[model samples]
Target: MSSAGGPAIGTITTEVPARLDRLPWSRWHWMIVVGLGTVWILDGLEVTVVGNIASRLSESGSGLPISDSQVTGLGAALYVAGACSGALVFGWLTDRFGRKKLFLITLAVYLASTAMTALSFSAWWFFLFRFLTGFGIGGEYAAINSAIDELIPSKYRGRVDLIINGSYWLGAMGGALLSVLALDTGIFPENIGWRLTFALGVVLGLVILLVRRHVPESPRWMFIHGQSDGANAIVEGAEKEIEEETGAPLPKAGRAITIEQRRSISFVEIGRTLFRAYPKRATLGFSLFIGQAFLYNAITFGFSSILVKFFGVSSGTTGYFFAVIAFGNFLGPLLLGRLFDTVGRKKMISGTYILSGLLLFVTAWLFDQGWLNATTMTVCWCVVLFFASAGASSAYLTVSEIFPMETRAMAIALFYALGTAAGGISGPLIFSGLTSSGVVSDAVVAFCIGAALMVAAGVVAVLFAVDAEGKSLEDIARPLSQRTKPTGRPAGPPSAPAV
Candidate 1:
């Protein structure tokens, strides 16, 4: 292959996919997980800190003159908007260029923007950087999810994807506890405490950048883009390393596939693939994303205000309650993730979404009756999120795997941007209005809205969820580049119309 402006383009028969899917679990795989998956922690930290610090930032001496409602409502909406925009631009670039390059570039963008946020002198300055931070994170979603799904073994893919996506809550837990300390005037001055939280996010991002440097480009991507030699070398290296680690030779790989290699897929092809070639899967992707995005945005962005206004909890003490629910969120995916593989994707995904939604409906009724304190409310959220979190993480898993190889990143970007825009942008705005009003009826309305969406998404899952567990991605959705046979048949049409 020539090292020029782009990868050399030509037809190539390769077994890169089968080789990758057959490897045993080893330390090398763990390295990839740690490097790629840890970014969600930073995202969780960014979101949770902003929510938890809204009240602090609105105080008399906090330097920025933002109000609580603006921070939670307008600021949160802008962040989601930035994320939606970033996902589209970067998702296309990731598919065209490569996963490693885009992931690294996106992370650097996040680090710089977050660092600037720490030095903001006004509310507009704070809001601008928040949007930029979301932009970087949004790109990470497209690049990272496609890369991880492409790289992980098929047997471990379902559970691993769930746990990695769910790791966001671990960062949420940290941010919640960190906010308690930062908001305390006894430890940090009012003006400096919130700024320190943003600064710390930058620091953690820098550490992750160092580790992410070593993660490889997806071998699946390389061969399809006309770098078959590079793809073969990577698979061979992995096989050697795994064999040494396990003290045994590996099994023979499955059949090779013939691919008419290309530089990139077009937006028109991507749209047809999503809407025409696989409409049912597209519906599943949108439903799962919209449901999770709205539910998470409503609760995550508005929970602090709900505690302070409705239950009379102190601003500084709200983090303790938030932390309990964040733990529940993380535990949900970690504990139940394996079940997605064991019991199967269709059953597990639908079950979690429906169960969580019903639980939230009950919690909303109790809150409407004024029969709960801050502690009881937090407990209710903990139980509701225990299932919702797993269901939410699976949304990412579903989008990444159900699409063709060339369109994986863009597919993830489209579903995330459109679905999140529908739910995420409006969720915080509505919840912020309701919770800030301090009216029990208004808050209950917000809860019911979120609960209803989850139930609706669960019903969609029952109708459309793919049975993707333990199946090779090629089997689920053939790459656009793949040919019908080695010699007998002509290469299939180079578009989704052929599918």
Candidate 2:
């Protein structure tokens, strides 16, 4: 048992970690991360495109009754609302059905909804379609992430997930570029831009479907679901390719657990596990999730909010400009992908939190001082997003690893749902309410408040976070090695890390 009164080594059954050095990765691993990440990117592209288009809707030829900002915020609100609902429902479904199945299904929903959204005309039609699209994206968040956690090898999981997670910015950047280019063309009318932007999403979705034929299921989930026969089939398939190259016996299984920590998982059951496991991991998971939900979403969703109203930028200029910022955000993760291994999860995450806060403060300061003009402000926002995305990307990686695989998805869903649901609702709401209330005049003032919130996020991580880099799932879950005291207290994540 752990020093904290959790499971002892002999208490529950789990696979033993093999030396990562001996393992060879097949294309399957990369495909899973990149493929799933690409789906998220498409979702991100659609979202950014919606933001670009919503800002122009009322002024477009269709003549929707609402103002562009109103449509944008309302569409976002509906989107977030759909996500909140999707998270609650799909988080459970992903856990119950397994990640890969749900991942593919959610992609289909997103593709269909994006097509519907493109065809929207009236305000109600647009709102409904966007809400549905957000709902699918919400489902994607849980399924894609859970699938990545289960599919990838433990040693490289964090880095893989980070790079994949980082691709959300790629989608955003793609949308921004397309929107800008389409707008600059002048051949297309104003309303046509939104349609073309959404059409790009359809193309991306089709690409995922074609490539998805090559993707595989989660062997871990198969193992847990009493499908060891099926899991072995997958392992054997991966093994065959490796053996071909190395001319050797592809290594075999970990020490299997006698008693699985997870029994039956449902959404309500997940809630029970989070609180009932009375596990520190569970509680810490919730807190970290809550903190991230409050900060990350607020910052991401609030970006357009700041640009449109607080920054006093014209509608025509904002979408194309924001696109550049999105490109940097995409690069931040893809370029720095290796740091999770070299720097260690604790320091990598801690540094990201602190640095993001510092950047946020800079953005706020520049805006408050009237030093950041449109060009400068856009650059600063992108830089802040780059760092913020880094920190935000890790929250899922850490949260999934902290729990045992038995309850891993449940824990992930619960924590993510709690944070994201709260965040999904709060981010746009807070920015709109606070800014519209006139409590803050400058965009920097609002950003200052955001930076302060991020500072809290930094403090939380440094105090609670532990380094998980290079550790196996078992090493993380019960921590057999570290807590070198009277009783074996596995080293937990340092206090914790958040958005």
lDDT of each: 0.91, 0.65
Number of the top candidate by lDDT? 1
Q: What is the Cα-based lDDT of residue 33 in candidate 1?
A: 96
The sequence of per-residue lDDT tens digits that candidate 1 reaches over residues 189-223 is 99999889989999999999999998989999998
The Cα RMSD of model 1 versus the native structure comes to 3.5
What is candidate 2's CA lDDT for residue 382? 76
What lDDT is reached at residue 121 by model 1? 88
Candidate 1: lDDT of 359? 97
Q: At residue 384, what lDDT does model 1 achieve?
A: 98
What TM-score does structure 2 among the candidates reach?
0.85
Evaluated at residue 253, the lDDT of candidate 1 is 72
* Deviating ranges (above 4 Å) for candidate 1: 1-4, 485-499
